[model samples]
Target: MKQGRSLLASGFVAFLLLSLAHSTLRIEPERSDASPTISDPAALLALQTRYRSLTRQLTQLTPSRPYIVVDTARNHLFIKRRDRIMLDAIASTGSGTILDKPGETAGQWIFDTPRGEFSVQSKLVNPVWVRPDWAFVEEGLAVPISQADRVEPGVLGAYALGFGKGYFIHGTLYPRLLGKNVTHGCIRLNDDDLKSVYQLARVGTPIMIF
Candidate 1:
């Protein structure tokens, strides 16, 4: 009976040891949902340094001389001289309307203000608007082959600054529509604003339109 009891105790101890080992094997490690942390300090510093360099390069690209900026979306103009705003005026830009010719292929004109960097190519006082073919078609008037019929006076107001390819920053007779997008492609301003822009901006003055 003593030997049997001892044998029973030994078997019980063996079973307990096996149970403990099974429980240890079933245990799992804890998990995380957060993103991985950056371990390298040098890569993070290099990214910050590149961002600062780009900002400095943008500041250097600004013009030192007087420049014109046209905001087509807002119908506004800003004349700046070396980071100072010389004039801020309400202006008219393109109407974004399409003029289509009936039964003609590739004969449509989209009246959109061209966006990019341009320069003042010419300046005119008491300017005459030589009406183009589109003007006559728009008005339902007969297209005149002669240049004399196309010449119109007192329509361009007192001053005009031509940029390039027939585009101009000019005065408009329609002063009530100064802040409206009502032009075919030109930039129109009120008399006082136009005079200010014409006098301040000279030939080769940079004009950035966006």
Candidate 2:
């Protein structure tokens, strides 16, 4: 319901902006001796009223608690509460590389990290990486026939926060690559930063990525 309202407010805001511009474009001299001025005061007043309504809608939609923001373009993660930033850490995001899907069909998987809002669905300690078929394919190895072969340990470091799908904000073994696009799709931070995030964020904490 909130998302629907947000969309509606956004559309309304756009419409008002366009209407305002159109109104401005339509402005002409009421008299040859007069300076240029607003042609329709009533329409402008209505737009201002709608703008106030939209402002309220936007204010109500703002997050009230601590949230996570991962800037994929800049490789930065911020843990923020309201207007204050609690933590700022260098991070690594998806590589945007593609891997050809194995088989006769023409298919491929892009490694770009997903964008938009998500919430922490789960948390983990001493997380284990269950390798996927892509991992094997990327390494030029055949997909393991047994499911047990996919299970790998000690790769995700001591802490992880799952934010839906298979994506996570987790610690990395290669701390040197903290500020680069190197992961498959997950957000990677150093051990210290990961620990701080793990401790501060709880299940259902909102995460915004772009």
Candidate 3:
């Protein structure tokens, strides 16, 4: 009978340890200081159109070009034109946490996407993930994981759109996983839609998430 009690205590202790171990995690890597130089006309045109549409939908005001509307609470993005919504698709948000502010930390902790006004600062194609050291130490994980581990698979590698300081609207490997607040701090989107967004948006495009 005593042995049985001991085993139960051991199991409980193990569970707590496991939970603590998983409290912190690293999804990908950090952004670099390099600026993207796009040279494709077709890609540039698409980005312009998308930006025009999204901007129109969000404000219900017509802009001469296309734009994007990101509503974190609704888990949807609207590509609009004039006063009409051209495209409406599911989007995965920041894990329900507010990390856009400076001096904040990153981890596996789940939270909702933050609501605020922001803008697309830049676009990156085949960009490298520069992992943060704080995430490593907090999670009891190693800082600066290997390049192999940093390279996430799927369309995410194809295009990554930066917004504000550290926030981004990027592609995801799991499109079906949209409509949920499940990203570390970035917004996740479908591959096709992301490609379209990538082509239409440019640096300085306004993004309002609420």
Return the top candidate by lDDT: 2
All models, RMSD in angstroms: 28.2, 7.8, 24.3
In the range 1-210, model 3's lDDT, one tens digit per residue, is 454334333333333333333332222343597545447888767656665554444343334345566777778987654445667878998765532322355344434555654556789987556555434555566655576654434545578888755677888778778998777778888878888888877775545565
Query: Predictions ranked by TM-score, top down?
Result: 2, 1, 3
lDDT of 2 by residue, 92-191 (tens): 9999999999999788888888987677889999999999989999999999989899998899999999987899999998999989999999999999
Candidate 3 weakest ten by summed lDDT: 19-28
Question: Candidate 1's residue-wise lDDT over 18-100, tens digit each?
Answer: 34544443334435765434456886566456545544443454465677888898999999764478999999999999998
Clash number for model 2?
A: 0
Listed in order, each prediction's TM-score against the native is 0.73, 0.73, 0.57
Q: What is the overall TM-score of model 1 with all chains considered together?
A: 0.73
User: Which is the leading candidate under TM-score?
Assistant: 2
Better of 1 and 2 by TM-score: 2
Instruction: Tell me the number of clashing residue pairs for each predicted model.
Output: 0, 0, 27
Q: Where in model 3 is the C-alpha error above 4 Å?
A: 1-62, 97-112, 134-139, 145-155
